[model samples]
Target chain A: MARILIIDDEEQLRDLLKQMLSRDGHEVVTAFDGVDGMRVFNQFNPELVITDIIMPNKDGIEVITELLCRNPNVAIIAISGGRRAITAEFNLESAEMLGVKGILSKPFTRDQLREAVQHALGL
Target chain B: MAIKTKNIIDFKSEAGRILLTSMGALLLLMVSAVFLSSYLETQLGSFKEVVFLGLAMVIALGAQWFLLKTIQSPQVLSPEERVHTTNEKLRHILNSITRQVESALGIKNTAVGGIENPADMLAATLIQCVAIMSEQVQSLLSALQMGSNESLEEARQSFIPLIDKTAETITQYLHVSQNIDNQLRERINETQQLLLNLRRELATVPQNQQQDTSQLFACIRQMGDVLETHLLIDNVVKKQLEVVTHDTNDSAFTLITLMRDLSDQAGNLVRYITETISKINAMENGVDESVGYIVRIGHFIQDIPEKIQRDIQAIQSASGVIDSLSYLVDSIKEISFQTDILAVNAAIQAAHAGDAGLGFKIVADEVRKLAVNSNKAAEMIEAGLDTARHTIHEGLKFKFLEEVMQQMNEAAQMMDSVKKLQEGHEDMRQYYKTLFTVINQSNMKLAQDISEILGSIQYQDIVRQRIERMQAAMQRRNELLQEFAIQLDVTSGNNMDDFATALNAVLNGYLEEESYHGNSLNSSDDGDQPPKFELF
Candidate 1:
């Protein structure tokens, strides 16, 4: 299994994702927000990153941009639960414009996560 | 007196008087000549008469000549008369020249238009100067006439001031002419300045127009650059969107396939769990039956020790009977000793009577043989009785019945433990059954959730398509705007129809897309309706 990173503001989601990916036999790292995520990303250097679009410090778009600048071929999957005015579609489309590997809306299932991850990693 | 006569002498009247006198003289001469001619004819003949007629003709000619001279010839008068006559002629000539000058200057003709140019103004000024000189000359002539009646010194005194006044008028005219020339020069300078200002204004107009034209062209070029940038951005966005759509579609398909497989697996697991539960129930029943059989077997074995004890008591009672039989065998042995003694006494009596009692001896011997046989039978019977009693006693000595009873109680306790273990197994089976049910329910819920997630994925794709359509419409709008900008001209009025048409097309496209999606531009609420996804 590929090394994966899960970044989200929600504690439960992060833990749940970490558990799921770990169960799937992937080495998983967790972060609370985009800022911490980037720090963790730099240190972990995971093969794939699953990041939430809207976050406290650095948003998913900025993270994607920075990561792409560092490594253009880095695998990225954007997820969003949609905030007040910004819908998940808008955020995901924005991520798509930045050339993300995959995107998932909020309330996605484990299977969907696995599918997106697999697809992103070209598995 | 000569002046008065000259004034009274009319030339026509003098000519008529001279003709009358000539005629009268001729008549008189003709009469005398007629008389002379008669006398000559009577005395000296017609020659003397012709001579007298000739004399009369000469006298008539002289009279006519004298009258013509008195009537036509200027009369010689005094010097004052000559001065007055010359003064009248000069005054008349001066008045005529002034009138001619006034007429030339249009002073006499009020109908003539005024001077229009500097030349005409100069001419008018000069004519005024001439008129002043003529007036001065007229005054000089008047002064000369007036002085004719006075002394020559008086005439000189009057004439000097009048000449000086005439010279002053000529000087004033010259000065006025010079001032008019100066004013004409100033007007020419003013006109030249006006022309220069007009030329400067005319020259500035084209430069301002050129600047404005250059600015307009720059604005057009800037607009073109803006349009080009917009087009470039549109193309890039279009390409990126295509890639996103393609990736999303593939992910969706893959997700759907995974869902199907998971659903099948879940169904199979539920089926397997149900089958396992059924098998466990059957096994539980079998276990219950085995427990019941063990309980019955335990009850049956529960009394084996007591039964063994009773059988051991019966064997002990049989051992007492063997003891009684041993006592009877001792009484028989005593009888055998007594019989042997009797046989020996009979045998001694039979020997004393030997020949005479051969029969008696034979009976005694036979009795002795019988006693011996009886003694041996008794010994054998006693020995058998003793052995039977000892064996019975030994068999009752060990506690075999207590041991069998202990083993039977232990078996009964083991049956109870088996029953409890079966009860625990039933509880464990129930717990496993509940766990399987929870697992099955969770699997179903998981399937439902996955289906919902798939729906959301489809929604994402739909939103993407809508956005793509919007991008396409915006691109078309930019293209139309560029076309409009290119066609825009300030000289000619704008072709608003093209703009309106293009805008309408864009709006119609939006409306069509919205309608196709079963949405309305006026509606803001989408409710909970799931978004439909199209692969394309």
Candidate 2:
């Protein structure tokens, strides 16, 4: 099983993801935002990472770029719900350009989340 | 005749210009009157003539004063020119009133059109109306200044119409302004009603928010209760699994230890059994040889008595022959003794016959001596033969044969003991073979039971993982409800665009990974498709 890191500001979402992946016999870690995710990423060095595109303090695109810089082989899955003048789609596109391996929309089902995680990890 | 009168009159006017001739006539008349009066005074009295002259001079003086006064007065202007002057003043006043009225109308038009502020325009229109009324009053006062009475009446008539027209225009402007004011009031009332409805809606927002929060809290509490129950059950199951696994491992260890010990013992047992069987076989072979030798010894002992009986018969026969020889020798001696007596008498005689007797005696003596010696030999032979017969009559050889028979009975008894010992060794070999087979079957059954127990303990790990996932999913759902509440409050006063921006910013804060796809995310995506797996 792979070790996975879930980064999101929604505390509930982070907990849910951690539980789901851990159930599959993988080690799971959680972070509340992009900044916290980066800090934990260095400590955990998980095989896969799931992140959100629109964020405060640090956005998903920046996180993706920085994470890739640190470890090019790190797997990433980006999630978002579009908002405001900067759409979720637009932000997600930018994240894709920055090098994310997978993408999922907000409010995804457990199966979809697992698929995205598994695919990113090369499970 | 009238012509002749006219000609005489013309002759008279030609001789004197009328006023000059009249004055000259008056002077002439005065002079004549004076003369007449003098003559009358002379005829009547002097006072009458003097009074008439005085009256004539006073009348003349009054006529001259009237004529000079008429000529010296200011020149009279024409009635037409005075009417024109009064009409000009009225025109000027009406023109000013027209301009003021036009300005008021323009302000009212602006107010009605809603271009300018209505209140400000209304004030300006009122001022313009007041100015128009004041200028109309001034035009009425100027109309009284006409020169001729007729021209004064005409100016009054023209000025009244102009003043009335100015008043009418001012009234029309006032009516238009009033209509605009009514419309403005109605619009203000409608705006006030809209504000009141907005205030009532704002007041109900807090109640709605509180109700939603309460519902979310209840859901969270229920989740917490369920999670507690799950945890308790999980712990119990985990402990049971641990115990089972530990027991299985111990059993396997015990089975292995027992098998090893059994294997060593079985090896020892097999070696012992084989050695015992070999010794028993050797013993059985030895017993066969011993039993055969005992039978042969029994046969040899049975033959020993017969051989001893044969030896006893030969000794008895030898004794009988010795007795017969003694008897014959005794008989010969007796006959020889008689012959010797006779031969002695004869020998004396034969001594005489001795030569012949000598020859005969020699022969006889020799014969007699031989006869005596023969008698002596027969007696000795009979003595020896008697002793031999007596010794042979005793039981010395039979005693030897009886001792041989006694030894043969001891050998036969020893052979019977050897046969009993061989039968006992054969019984022990059969008992050892049955014991080895029973122990080998018991050891195999113990090894199989331990293997089954070890397999049951590995399934517990998967169950533990599933319980943990359920707890996490519930907790996350509770947190999402809280976020939705906060988002609702934030967007109540702002527009939809601003709310969208705020909500997106908050949600984006949690993102952790790299995004590799375009924003094709649909929140409402529903499908029956199963998940896909890949090897990265």
Candidate 3:
């Protein structure tokens, strides 16, 4: 089982991802935003990370960049909800450019999450 | 030429025209005084004529001073210059209006930058514009009051339409701005309602999501537990089936063995009963034979008395015959004795008649000899018959035959008792056969009941599968609830960074578009964006 981290400004989504990944038999950690996610990331040292774009303090792009800088081999899955300024597609593309391994839109299904996690963990 | 020049000068100066008119009147008075002086020298003295002349000069000097003083008052500007000066002042007021309008637009932009509601800023801008216009109107009115030239009055009269036009324009502007303000207020109110609804929904979302997530976790845990329990039950049931099957096999073996033993016993009993019945039948047949022989012997023994009785009767008849014969023989002997006597007499008589008497004596002697023979035979017969009759009487007694008959009756009674004993053995054998059949039927029923119980153990597996399916369905429902909460978060716009970024982008776009139009109306460039809308 892979150890996974979930980061999002939405607490409900964070908890949901954590629960879903945990149910797949992976160890899961959660954070509310980018800053908190970084703290939890260092503390947990998870093999995989799932993050949401357009968060407070720092967004998914910065979080991915920082995580990659710390551990070049760390895996990342980026999720985004479209806002007026940035579309979900744009955010996802940006995260991809920053070396995120996977991307998902808001309101994704359990199957989508599982597939994305599996890809991120190379499982 | 001088008159025309003087006329032109008089036309340019009201004071100069008044002075000429007063000089012409004074000259007419002097000519009239000269004529009046000759007439007055005749009527009155020279002193009266000199006083009239002095009064006329005083009148002319006073008229000149009054005309000069009236011309020197400061209301004497030219009509063209007054119109020029009034036009310049009107331009100043128009410039002030333009500046105020620009300032109002500037204030509007700056206020919009700080405020979320654009209507509030617009209203403030309109108020400032009105105030600036009011101050400029007051300044224009005071400047108009300081100079009262007749040309300025004409200029002021012409400027009335321009002020009315400015007032009309301001009124129209205020009216339009107020309408925009009202529209913006209504839109803002609607937006507030939408935001409030969103906030309320968002406020409840976390708690609801937490509860649903908890339930989901619990369901997953329950599903795990159910899986474990199902596996355990399966294992247990499998093991139980093996044990039960093994036990059933053993029991079946035992049952078959017992059935075999019972069958063997039943067969043995049936054979034994058949053999015993056959033996008893044989014994019964022997008893029947004995009974038949005893019956025959009884009948024969019963006939022996009758045969003895008949033999006695025959012997009696023989004795009777012998008695009769003895009697006859007695008679013969008597007769013979008598005949011998007679013959003796006859012979004596015959000596008397010797020859005739000789025949009679022969006859008598022959008769006497025959009679003697007859009496001797009769005596012999009577003695033989007496001996036979005594032997027959001794043999006629049935006492020994009666003892033989009693012995034959006892043998028949013994045969009947043996027949009863054989019947009792046959009845006992039938009773044992019926008991064996009942025991065999009961064993078969017990075996069937055990087999039925072993078949019913699969129901537990069915129950386990139903539980597992229910847990799986609940897990799916939990996942759906989680997705619903995520969607709620996305739509709520609770993340301020994203919300603000979206607002900025939208407002900038709106302002850029508006600025394109604003430059045409106000002759000013606007680059800064403002807040687009505000809600609760």
Which model is ahead, 1 or 2, in terms of TM-score?
Answer: 1
* CA shift of B433, model 1, Å: 2.8
Candidate 3 local lDDT, B1-536, one digit each (tens): 22234345647787676766677667667756775665667466666666776676676667666665566643354655544543443333223323332333343344322222332343344334333433433433343344223333343344344434433443443344344334434433433433343233234323423343443333223322322332232232233223223332333334334333333333333333344345446545655765566677567667877876776678678768767866776776677677667766766776778787778777767766766666676567667767766765665445446656676776577566556545444433333332233333323433443333222212222222322332233233223323322432343212222322332343344334434423121122222322122111
Residue pairs in candidate 1 whose N, alpha carbon or C atoms collide under 3 angstroms: none
Per residue, candidate 2 scores C-alpha lDDT tens digits across A6-110 of: 888878878887888888898989888889989999899888888886666776766787787677678999988754223455445445544579888777898
Top lDDT model: 1
Off by over 4 Å in 3: A1-123, B1-219, B222-251, B352-359, B380-536
Q: Write down the worst ten-residue block by lDDT for model 1 chain A.
A: A82-91
What CAPRI-style quality would you assign to candidate 3? incorrect
Q: What is the C-alpha lDDT of each candidate?
A: 0.57, 0.49, 0.51
**TM-score for each of the candidates:** 0.28, 0.25, 0.29
Tens-digit lDDT track of model 2 for B419-515: 4544434333222222222222222322332232122212222222222332233233224333433433443212222323332332332111101
Error of 2 at B492 (Å): 30
lDDT of 1 by residue, B251-348 (tens): 44444444344334334333444444565566566567667767776776777667777978898789778778877777877776777787778778
Residue ranges of candidate 1 with Cα displaced over 4 Å: A1-123, B1-407, B478-496, B518-536
